[model samples]
Structure formats: C-alpha cells, structure tokens
Target: MSALAKQTITEQEFQGFAVTDFPASKRLKVVTLDEATIRAFNDAVSEWTVQGIEYKPFLRFEVADRLDAITNYTLGKFLNATVRDRATGAFLLNYQGSPNVEEGDARTEFEVKLSTAVSHIIGLSNHDAMYGQYYARFTVRNVDDSDSYLRKAHRRMELHNDGTYVNERTDYVLMQKLKEENMQGGDSLMLHLDDWAELDKFYKHPLAKKDIVWGAPKSKNVESKVEHPVFFEEDADGKPLMLYIDQFAEPSNKAEGKYLYEMGESLEADANFLSVPMPVGSMMVMHNHFWLHGRDKFVPHPDLCRELLRQRGHFTE
Candidate 1:
C-alpha cells in the first residue's frame, strides 16, 4: 500500500467513494465518488437553491455535512488528513456518473454547489475579489487579452504558489473544471517542494529569506502589494513554506532579480512535476504552500473554450 493509502480509513472500499493513488504521483490521492453518492447528495441539497446557499453563509457547511453524512463522515476525515499531511497534501475528486441535472446553467449551479461542499469540507473559501463571490467562475478561450496568464490559452502558465499577494494566509486551493469545448491540451500541472531537485540549493541562499514585493494585475482586483520572502515561514518540523509567482514578483536590484529569476527557471525545468488532466465536474484541492501548481498551454483552436471554478482559502483546523 502507498503512504497515502495507509492514512485513509477506507482504502479498498468506502461508503460512497474509493481512494487510489494518482498515476503520476503518490502524493496526490484520487477520490472517485460512487454514482449513489452523487444522486443522494443532489437529492439532499435539492431543497436549497444555489442562491439560498449563497444568501446564508452557514448553509455551505450544512451542505458539506450532508455530503459527509452520506459517506458515514469518512470522506471528510480522510480528506482533512490527506491535505494536512505534508507527505500527501492534495487530492483529485471526481464522480463516476452524472446527476439529475442537465447541461448549461443548471449543471453549472450543481457543480458550484459540489465544489462548495468540497471546499467547506476542509476549509472555507475566501471571497474572490475578481468574481465577487466565495467561488469564482472563469472561462478560457483561444484568443485572450487578460492582464494575467490566468485566461490566456496559448502559453504555459509557469509553476507558482497562490496567495502570494493577498494578506490572508491561503492554506489551500481548490480548482474545478465546469465545462470544456474543443480543448485539446490544457492540463493542470503540479509539483511538491521536496520533489524539486534544487530546493535545498535555493532554500539556503540569502535571498530566500529576504522580503520581495508581490503585486497582481488590475484584473485580479488586488491593488495593494505585499512583501514577503520565498521562504516566508516553516512548519513545526522546520520544512519550508513558499509563496511565489514569476509574473507578480518585483525585485528592486540585480541580486534580488537574479535570485527570483533562477528560482523560476529551476522550478520550470524540474522533471518531477505532475501534469493532470481535469475532466468536467472534477476538482483538485491542494495545500498551497508546499505544492506549486500551473497549467499546460492549450492547443490553438478558435472555438476552444474551457470554464473553470476556483476557491482558495486557509484551513479551518
């Protein structure tokens, strides 16, 4: 059995889902919910509309509890443990069958709620300034004019950590795929800090602990900049906690610039990163600090479009 499999209660079989190691990396657990769990969850939450859940903040946790209850609460416990463990701090959640809802707005609403339940299971999602909600839904197309690489489809998004510019401590990031169209080559990319071959080479460097400026573009709705080093803090066991992005860092001098440059170059060149293809209604939640994530560029197609939902926030426990 894998290390992550050892931590889970239901390895071979569970109440509503089954757990397995991702093919690319053992650090990521793949949780596939049975069809019954999907139908039962839909029926349970049918009484509450997406609008109603949004109006009542606490209803989100109620939805989370309802789903967990269907699985005998084992799913929640396993997911919490998986994310908190540095040895395995991520999971890919996808269902086996379709629910009662049809495609379009109804389907999107169902997915939003599904992601919400998953998000609250481990942590509460922060209000997204860009989308003006607890969860943000955005689309990517062949042609793009976005200020950041988030919506661009032609080029690869370099590996980096989230919450670099935000004041809040973003402990987790949840990314879900809502829709896809003519999309050929857009897969989610991930890498653990310990897996990076040059981690120690950069961690011991002087600039690794020096404060660097980080700022987002106007599209992100974050006007203020924050200051922090690449290795901002450490875990209880003294492991490094990182917050960085190649596009957002602002170095004032040559030394700072070179340090940031080499770090980005090393991360991009690392061969240990995992490239995951996210199917519709599938979501991946990861510990934001130790795990670096990005997206592989999509194949050029005029009609290509992919809708995605994102929720990033700190862990509750």
Candidate 2:
C-alpha cells in the first residue's frame, strides 16, 4: 500500500474542488475545480501571458502559486500527495465550468498557460525534443504521414511510457486535450504497473534488467540510440520501476525480441487497463514509471482533427 492510503484529510480542507474516483478506476482521483476557483485562478494570472511565462521560468512557479493560493494552498498539497503516493499516483484535473476565454487561438493559448501553471506546481517540465519547447502541442488530422504511431489515427498507439529514448528524467506525464473535431473512439488508455496481472512474470525474467537499445524515428528528431533496462530501478520501497516502449526499443537478439514481444502482448491483453475519455480542457497526469499510457484508434474521417498538448518532466523536491 502507498503512504497516501493511510493518510486522511477532512472533506472541508479542499475549498472549491471535489475529489472522487474515476468511473472505471478507483485508484485514479478525479479532481474537479469549481467555477469560482477557476475564475479566481484565471483572473489572478491574467497579467502573465504565455510569452511572459516562457521568457521567465521563475514566473511559472508564481503562476502555480497563485492558482494554488485560491484554495488556501490545499489543492497543491493534495495534488502532490496524491501523485507521490504509489497506490494512487494519477489524477484527472478538470474545471466544473469553462473559463471566460474566446474560442480558437485565444482559447488554445489559455489552455497552454493553464497547463503550464499546473505542471509547475508539481515540477518543471522537460524540453520536448519533438517540439523544441517545454510543452508540445500537436494535432491529429485525418491524414498523417508521420514516421511513428503517434499521429496515426487509424490504430491504437500501444501502451508505453514517455522519455524512453531520451536521457531526461520523466517523472510525470501531463496530457491535455485542446481541440477535437469529427472524432470518435480515441479514448486515452492507462495501465498501472501493480494492476498488470503479468507484472511478476516479466519483472522476474532475466532480460528485465538487461540493457536494451532504444532509438527514435526521424520525426522525433532524436538521432542517437540510448540503452536502459525494462525495469530501470526500484522506488523507495524497492518496487519495480518500468521504462519500456514497444516502438523505439531495438532488441539485439531473439531472446530480447521475444521478451519484449511477449511483454507488449501481455499489456495489451490485460483487462485491468483503464480507458479514459478526456474532454476539451481536461488533462490527465500520471507517474511515468508506474503508469503505462496510450491512445485508442480514432474514427476515420476526411476532416478529422484533434489537437493535444503534452508535457513530460521530473518532480521537484
């Protein structure tokens, strides 16, 4: 059990947010901020535009502090505690009512700023190689000629962790839906390591700790191949920490190949995985090692377009 499992707090502690279990998964905490709280946050940070926040990194923390201050600092403490707890290291944060922002570019810019503030409250986001920025915003259109499975709309992206091929410490991953049009059947998929039925079968395997080569495709813009074990390390309690991705891993031999192949198959077939539907302006944040995330296939349409914002980074003490 995680430390959070034993910790208790009164309901009155959180002023304008309601905490509840997600429909399909009890482990995930759904935090919905009230309209008043959202308005207060937006109003407090209205002066710091996205450009200003980007230019001054310290200002990002100020933005986070302002948002947290609205809840008397209870929201930040609760969020950090929930994310650090192994038993429940994930949360879906969405406001009860929409902010007073215009549609189109203006709304998208506000979404980016809001996500940035939330991320800074927990930790600093790593520079995204794909976008050359602290956060990445990309769209999934009806036609995609991308090299990897990321932008492909017709097939599932597969269960995997982020920062597999990169050297950065990706402690957490935040994915927010910005816009969607003519979309269906593209729910986010998540599988907790502890909930995976076959975790022990693979974790105890010989190749679990063996170094495997990983390389990204052209679109990723990462030229070199990095090496790491599937079970990269253990947590403070000595539990396994996984870092595996099906697409980028380059198994050198038949044994390694077989091991990875079986692991992927096991993950896909696991019944404990959660299929989460993210509405516009909602974001899902999870511990990178303990949680494996993916995307379901999208319904085909000539004008299908879904814009998403992503940030992967390490936690700050």
Candidate 1 yields a Cα-based lDDT of 0.92
Off by over 4 Å in 1: 1-13
Query: TM-score for model 2?
Result: 0.96
Which portions of model 2 show Cα errors greater than 4 Å?
Answer: 1-12
Model 2, residue 36: distance off in Å is 0.9
Residue 35 of model 1 has an lDDT of 92
The residue-by-residue lDDT of candidate 2 on 159-196, one tens digit each, is: 99999999889999999999999999899999999999
| lDDT of candidate 1 at residue 277, scale 0 to 100 | 93
- Each candidate's clash count: 0, 0
Model 1 per-residue lDDT tens digits across residues 1-317: 24565656545346899889999789999999999999999999989888998889999999999999999988888888889888889999999988888889988888988999999999988988889888888999998889999999989999999989889889999999999999999899999999999999999999999999999999999899999999999987899999999999999899999999999999999999999998999999999987999999999999999999999998895
Highest-scoring model, lDDT: 1
